[model samples]
Target: MDGTRDPLARDERAELHWLRAENTLLRVQLDILTDIATGYAHDVDTILRLRADR
Candidate 1:
């Protein structure tokens, strides 16, 4: 019996694996962006408070 059984089935499985890996990478990047945005927001708030005090 052939290992592939069906060539399309093998290809589909490979594609799905690649997509899952890509999705994981995107999620990690999005989390990093969110963190950066939150940091910037905090910095802006601090600056605003200092300006208001003057």
Candidate 2:
């Protein structure tokens, strides 16, 4: 109900946005791993040979 509270609200929104992005990335990673685990040799090989920049 004051200007002081605005900064905290902004920080919370930024954190929530970051968390959502991370969650989406993790879900995709899990899906890829699941595919590889389910006998997808191409996916397995691709993962094995991947040179992740980060």
Q: For residues 1-54, write the lDDT of model 2, one tens digit per residue.
A: 555644458889899999999999999999999887777777776787785533
- In TM-score terms, candidate 2 sits at 0.58
- The per-candidate count of clashes, in order, stands at 0, 0
RMSD of 2: 11.5
Give TM-scores for every candidate, taking all chains together and pairing residue i with residue i.
0.82, 0.58
Best by TM-score: 1
Give the per-residue lDDT of model 1 (tens digit) for 1-54.
756665468889899999999999999999999999999999999999999999
lDDT against the true structure, per candidate, is: 0.94, 0.82
